[model samples]
Target chain A: MVEAWQWVTKHPDKLAGWTLEHIWIVSVAIAIAVVLGVALGIYISRPGKEHIADSVLYLAEIMMTVPSLALFGLLMLILGTIGLKVIGFLPAVIALVIYGQLPILRNTYIAIREVDPAMIEAGKGMGMSERQLLFKVKLPLAVPIIMAGLRNAIVLLIGITAIAAIIGAGGLGVPIFRGLRNARMDLIIIGGVSVSILALVVDGLMGRVERWVTPRGLKRR
Target chain B: MIRLDQVTKIYPDGTEAVNEVSLEVGEGELCVLLGPSGCGKTTTMKVINRIIPITKGKIYIDGTDTTKIDEDELRRNIGYAIQEIGLFPHMTVGQNIQVVPALKGWPKDKRSERAEELLELVGMNSAEFMNKYPSELSGGQRQRVGVARALGADPPILLMDEPFGAIDPITRVRLQDEFLKIEQEIKKTIIFVTHDIYEAIKMGDKIALMNEGRLVQYDTPSNLLFKPKNEFVEQFVGADRALKGLQLIRVKELMTGTPPLAKADERVVTVQARMEREGVDCLAVVDNEGKFLGWVDRVNVGKGETVRDIINRSVATATANAVLSEALSLMLSSGFKTLAIVDGINKLEGVLSFDAIQLALSEVAQRRGSE
Candidate 1:
């Protein structure tokens, strides 16, 4: 613990770089996950898709069961020299994207389903088209929860990102794997602290954003 | 005008929410669908706009089949407001009001201008609130914004689902009063859904009582109160409730002033003499053309000043369709017992009082029991 504390204090600039790399992975993953996951979640949540949700859930479960290492290895094997050249960032990103999708999709589906029926009815009563109801009323209200899931997923991704160091992803994961290899406790602490700080940072920022989007008091206007 | 012929809504779960209900609302009339929650009042409303597909039936808006219009095109032409006041939290009041107009692809300036106008119409007054976010508003303010957002496009028809249900009683009464006044001026065909009987009576030009997914009774507010078709309608409308009928009686017949009026130049002493001769407690002060100027109390006028000089200025002269809840509140707040009712042109219509309400409710109740 002292060693980790000393590393964070002594090499704050290096820690900052490590933190940036950690954040890079999280933000990229979140951006992609937000777009794709939310869109997919909305599509699956739409009416007449009860069966499709089952299929998607099954597929995601299968993906979740795949070893993160094995999944990246497979990407590496496919990319060959190309994989080694980009420092294997693609493999890490793909793996995190796969793992990050579940919470987002689930939250989005539940949020859309859970929106007060009266609101949707009001939209329809006023002659709102399905698209309008979904976009204008349902989706906006659903944003807070969807963002919650995204936050959880991104924070979770920060921890999982350390595993991507195996694929040579340029992040604090570098120090982690290097420390593990050389049996250097100081490098490991630096890596772990950097990753944790990244997670806290992402979670905190997203939390603020969620409050801004959803607002707290009823008299927000 | 809206006409629903044999409209039925059957959820995929084989549950029927609205069962072969047929109803009609005339143009320039306000209609309320009054029922307990889950009584299909909401489902029936959704079916009109095709939000939920109808299992069977046809819906006509302005006499045109609703199914024939493009869903987006049709919805863009209709305004919707709900009790939760679903103004997008991410949107400013102006942006929230601009959604429909933007969807309709109206020019940017026209849409923004329209939103401003609607904000004013709903009493939010855009100049003060257009830039505000939904989160910054109180319940009543949010509701006003919701109404303004709905009215942004000025559609011929509006659908409101318990729009004022979430506000505090005081704010609710204020919003309800303003809504009634706006409706009088706009006269758009409107379908309103609410569980509050008082709200239904006050807002609906015609109220449709629904029970178990079926429309039990549909008629004018006074007619429904006077002649409920069944025990269900009567029960739903509530029995032994405090004078529901009083809210329905038009204010025109209740004012007790015996045709006392004063010209712009009429002296205080002259008006007092006229009041004494008529034995009237109040005088309807009007301009030369007989427009509703304001109200003056005969008992409170000072002998030393003109009738106008000493007359108590009050918050009356609202449209005759205003509810007793509002009238009573204004009276109580202003420490006055009565308010002058006005017509569309601000002409003297009648006066409203708590005793007058009781008398009207009693008469209607007696009449209903006899019927």
Candidate 2:
């Protein structure tokens, strides 16, 4: 414990760099996931597309079942064949984004689908065009639930991002792997602790964002 | 003014919701489309605003064909409300009420001012309710906000499909009365849809009674009650048509102007002699200015020196403007054979009697029989 504390204090800059890298990878991957997932969600949730939505949701569920490391390996292989970087940031982001799809996609689809039909009817009756109804009524009402999914994707990506170090993606995982290779307990402890703290801080920030974006009328007193 | 010329709506599934229904609602008229569920009353109303598109025929709004206008533009000019209220839960009451105005690109201050004006018009205090969400409001309050929202842009035409249907019975009646009062001031040409017979009678200047997707009869509430076009119309109006007709007649219409009355300073014996001459058991005692003081009955006339000495201040009285149905209920509940019809300040106007109400009903029956 004493050794771990001293090492962390002495190498604060190194710790900060790894934490920033971890945050960057997770943020970028989750951002892409949100766009793709929400767009797909809206597309699939349109009327007469229930079968397509069901099949897409099923595919997302199947993708979620793939182990993170195995999915990363699969992406590495696929990207290598496509003449892209076989290891590091590209594959790591790709893997995290794939993993992030289920929560964000499912939530967006369900949130949009679950909006009250009567509200949509009322909007139409009041002369709101289809586009106006989507932006003004449906999307605003779906924000809280979609944010829940976003938070889930973000937290999941942050944790999984540490594993990217194996492919030389360079996050807090680098220290833990190096510590294991050299039998350094203090290094491993610092890396593990930093990743945990990073996940918690990011999750807390996302929680605040979720609450902020939620419509005031939707909030429970 | 709105006119439907043989408007027909047959859904894609081959269900004819509104079949060749022709009706005209004049400017500022509150026309009720009343019928049983699945009778296409709601469908007929929705057709006016093109919410449910008509498959055949045409609707004309103030001499312009509805199809000639852009649907959104047409709908924007026609205020719409439904039974569910459908108030956007995420919006504040003010925001909800300002939706159409905001859509029309009104300046923010103007839109908000309109919302405040409408909220007050619906009996909601803007200060207390402007920022509150629909979820925070009670059902009746939400309903009022729904109505306020419908009147947002001050549309000359309004389509209300059971706007008060979801409220409790007492609140529903209150809301209806308040809405009618609002209608009087705004004078918008409104097409109100409801299944409740009493609501149709109370709210509609003219009722378009539909059945099985066809116009069964279109007439005033009194005509619908007394001169039903056919057996179906009579049955639909129900067996208690005469009693329902009472709802249409105001107390002042049947009330006798020459009511048995005694001055507060008049001798009790003299008032008793007058009551006997008028063939009434009681006389409405009034002050010198004709402001109603109380009542003096034959039984108490002999025990007092003056009418004021035995005046029964608890005697039930109705306003001259009150419907006979209200007067009847007040008389029945208060165990009075006659009600002194007074003005707002309790000045004696006339007397509404049980016998007069009976005579009114028999006269209506005789008129129906002669017809």
Candidate 3:
């Protein structure tokens, strides 16, 4: 561990670059997951779309049950054949997006579903249009719940981004993968500690954001 | 006035929620749509505002077909409230009340003024509550804000579905009384829904009772009490129908002219003489200005020199506007056969005797039987 600390201090720039890269990849993937999850959740949760919701949730569940590395490898082959970036940042981000889906999508679906039906009826009865109801009532009330899902996705993806280093996406995972190759146990400990710290920081920031966006009406007395 | 002609609602799943119900609520009338749960009372009310589109009939509001008008435009003109209140949790009390007015494009100043005015109208302190969110309010307060929100536009017609159902019993009664006061001042044509028959009797000018998606009986509260259309109504109204009927009748309805009076200054012998001449056991004592002082009973005669000294001051009194049930209870609790009917100033207005109430109910029963 002391040796790894010396090594890290000796290469501060490299460590900083990998940390930024790790953050960027995780953020992009979580952002994509949030948009996709919320939109799909809203569509499936609407009244009179039960069958569509069932089928979509079932497919997402099956996708969730699959092994993450195997799924990432399969995506690499498909993207490689399609002549897209398949080896590094793109494949790694895509894998994280897929992994982040269940938390975001499931939470969004349940949150939107759990909104008081009477409130929606009142909105409709008071002459609010479909679009107005969604924006003014549904989305505002669902924000806290949805934000919680985003926080979960961010933390999960931050940790998963380490695995992406195996596919050539340089991050904190590089040290661990190098440790594995060169039999450096101290480097592996440093990499594991860095990923844990990164998850906590992302989680703490997102929690504050969630608290800020939570509807004032729903705040505990 | 709002009118529904053979309004029916059959969902896609073949559940006929409302079946060909026809009704009319006159201008300024508060009509109650009442029944047990799932009896389609709510569906019947929704059809009036076109919230639940009618499967087979026409609804007219102030002589305009509801279906013919643009739905949003039509709804904007009809106030709606429900049991759960459904106040926008994200909005403050003022913002919740201003929703309809804001939707109609009222200027900011006008909307704010209207919200304050309505909060006061519903008996809330506007300055204290305007900025508070719904969760911060008690259930009863939230219910009041719900009503204020519904009345935001001062719409001529209002639809309320068990608006007070979620409140505690004590608060529910207070809300009901407050609503009654507001109704009298505004006189908007209203269709209120409830399963509690007592609520229907208290709030409705007319009651339309439903069962199994059909209209069972539609009539005034008095008629439903004294002349139920069938056994179902009698059972639905419960065995206390006679006692409930007294609520529909007022002290003024049963009161006759004030009985012969004895002046407070009059001698005890004079009070006895008057009671004797009138063939009654008591005479109401009055002051110089004719305000009721108390009653001088025959038993109190000779107790003192004057009527004031002998007067039974603890004798219960009833107001002219008080329901007969209230007066009756006062009489029963006081062990008196008659109650003094007083005006706001405690002046003698008339007299309400137990015989009069018995006569009124019997007359209603006899009239219904003869019909």
Summarize candidate 3's per-residue lDDT along A1-221 as a digit string, tens digits.
79888988898887888899999899889889989999998988888988998888888888878777787789889998999988898899888888888888888888888889898888888888878788888888888888888898898888889989999988999888999999999779878989999999878988888878888887776
Q: Judging by lDDT against the true structure, name the best candidate.
A: 2
- For residue B121, model 3's alpha carbon misses the true position, in angstroms, by 0.3
| Total clashes in model 2, counting residue pairs 3 or more apart in sequence or in different chains | 0
Give the distance in Å from residue A183's predicted Cα in candidate 1 to where it truly belongs.
4.4
Error of 2 at B55 (Å): 2.1
Q: Per-residue error at B240 for model 3, in Å?
A: 3.8
- For model 3 chain A, the run of ten residues with the poorest summed lDDT: A63-72
Please name the candidate that would achieve the greatest DockQ relative to the true structure: 2
Q: Order the candidates by lDDT, highest first.
A: 2, 3, 1
Ordered by DockQ, highest first, the candidates read 2, 3, 1
Expressed as tens digits, the lDDT of each residue in B1-371 for candidate 2 is 89999989998989988899999999999999999899999999988878888999999999999999998889899999886559998999999998899888899999999999999999889999999998899999989999999999999999998999877875775677668668879999999999989888878899999999999999999889888899889899999877787777777788888476788888888887888788978888788788987778888866879877898888777766566777888789778787888764678888888998988878767766776
lDDT of 2 at A35: 96
Higher-scoring candidate on TM-score, 2 or 3: 2
Which CAPRI quality tier does the interface of model 1 achieve? acceptable
Task: Give the runs in model 1 whose Cα sits over 4 Å from its true position.
Answer: A1-39, A54-90, A103-114, A123-139, A149-155, A167-221, B12-16, B35-39, B166-174, B195-198, B227-245, B256-319, B323-371
Between prediction 1 and prediction 3, the one with superior DockQ is 3
Over the stretch A1-221, how does candidate 1's per-residue lDDT look in tens digits? 78878766887887778678867886787788878889999999898998998798678768778887888877777667664443466767877898888888888988998887766665555556688789878888787788889888888888888888888787888888889999999898778877777778768988887777773332233
